[model samples]
Target: MMKKLENFAIQDFQNDLINWYRNEKRDLPWRKNQDPYKIWVSEVMLQQTRVDTVIPYFNEFTTKFPTIQALANADEEEVLKAWEGLGYYSRVRNLHSAVKEVNECYGGIVPNDPNEISKLKGVGPYTKGAILSIAYNIPEPAVDGNVMRVMSRILSIWDDIAKVKTRNLFEEIIREIISQEYPSDFNQALMELGAIICTPTSPSCLLCPVREHCAAFHEGVQTELPVKSKKKKPVPLQMAAAVLYDENGQLYIHKRPPTGLLANLWEFPNCELKQELNKTHTEQLALFLKEEYDIEAALQPLIGTIQHIFSHRIWNLSIYFGEIKSMESEKLVQVDEETIKQYAFPVSHQKIYKMYKGEI
Candidate 1:
């Protein structure tokens, strides 16, 4: 059972938070309108990404696909192109699939009901709550990391915020106290407070609007209330990428498989270096070319190495410039810069391309 909040009035807390929000909230682009489609896009983009980075992406995305129907009508490649720099490709794919469903089934209107909206692809509890409360003014708790941080400090909860059960506990607490008349601003205020004031380290407790109700602040433990378990280290991987050039001066590129990491994006011909291939990078490239593509190639000196760090993997990529001597298969295509520009390349491959063009 959850403990009841004490020593402070809920009504006063709500008023203070709402008043501070009205005066101090950042003028984000998504706040300019209450359109559900725009709001949903912003919420998805803001996941695992900073607000400043999301601003340009949100603006470009809205400009291209202003309406749900427009997004549904766009090709998957076009949508991926628009989301090129955004690391999480699956979000864009799910958003694209969800918009298509909304366009066909709901006449391009984002459903207001929580259950109906949650049924869409990639629409989790938090996303559903955000869309309903922020766009439609529904009284639902949007418990993201920020909201959990703020609530954990206010109530002085000691549970591990990283655990699933702890998140559910926070949700229940929020549902009980969330503002009914102004759910949008109320939830945004909680998130904004966590982002700027009740931060993970060295929180600004003195400047807090609802400091009187902050149990952790009174106990002088605001920074330590929201406990989270440590994450495991990312696995390191070594890779070799070959920038193959044909006699016609066209670069060889291939599309990734339809699913898994970096699905459907184009990339330079590369292979992970296994323990068995203990040869030098150039020797490995020669072997990979002969075995995978049945092509005879001569690898030039190592051009450079590009380091790309994903959430769970760190790729140390060694790039090599090579010329195709003879071809025995048709697995890879040779394309010029103009043709390659039409396809979305993963950021790692993009870095190699920039190096080839002397841009980096």
Candidate 2:
């Protein structure tokens, strides 16, 4: 069972937080309206992305697919194109799938019921709570990392926030003290506090409105209260990529497999180098091209290397420029710059393309 705060303390905390929020909240684009669709888009984009970076993408996305029907009717490729630089391609895919369901089953309206909304493809507990509370003013607790930090500090809860079970603990505490009359402002206030004041490191405790009730602050352990285990270091990987050109000066690129890292995106053909190759990088590229695509090529290394990092892997990429002597694979397409521009390439491959065009 969760520890209960005194009734008077809960009232005081709610009043101070809500009042501070009304006076100090930033004028964000999503805050301009309470449309569930717009709010849902913002929430999805904001995951694992900073607010400043999300603003332009959010603006572009909403403009392109302003309504649930607009998003549902859009081709998956177009949606992926709009989300090209976002890095997390799966989010857009799931969002697209969910929106199609909403359009078909719910008449293009985001479901307000908690159970119904949670059943959507990408809607988790936090997302369901955010939509229900912010869009419909339902008294649901939105416990994101920000909210978790704020609550953990305020109540001095030492549970590991990284563990899935701890989310319920925080959610229960939030449900106990949430402002029923103003659930939107209350949850946003908690998130805002964590973002601006109760930060991950060196929190601004002096400016905190709920400082009086913050047990961690009084106990002098605010920075360490919300315990999270450290993540393992990313595994390093060596990869060889080929920037193949044909007699007609067209570049060779192919789509990735439909469901994995960088799924369905266009990229220069590449292969993982398991260990240090006995041959030169250029020779390795030639052999890989012949073995994988049955294409013979004269290969030379580019002037520099391209290193791209993902969440769990670091790609130490060596790029090679090659002239294709003969073509064999039907899967590989040779296209000019105009045709290439029509396809969405992963950022790592885009770097190679930029180098090919002398842009970097």
User: Cα miss at 220, model 2 (Å)?
Assistant: 1.5
Give the local distance difference test score of model 1: 0.90
lDDT of 1 at 333: 81
Which lDDT tens digits does candidate 1 get at residues 97-198? 999999999988999998899999988889999999999999998999999889888887888989999989988888888899999999999999988888
Stretches off by above 4 angstroms in model 2 are: 4-8
For model 2, where is the 10-residue window of minimal lDDT?
1-10
What's the distance in Å from true for residue 101, model 1?
Answer: 0.3
Model 2: residue 108 alpha-carbon error in angstroms: 0.6
- Against the reference, the lDDT scores of all candidates come to 0.90, 0.89
Reference-based lDDT, residue 203, model 1: 90
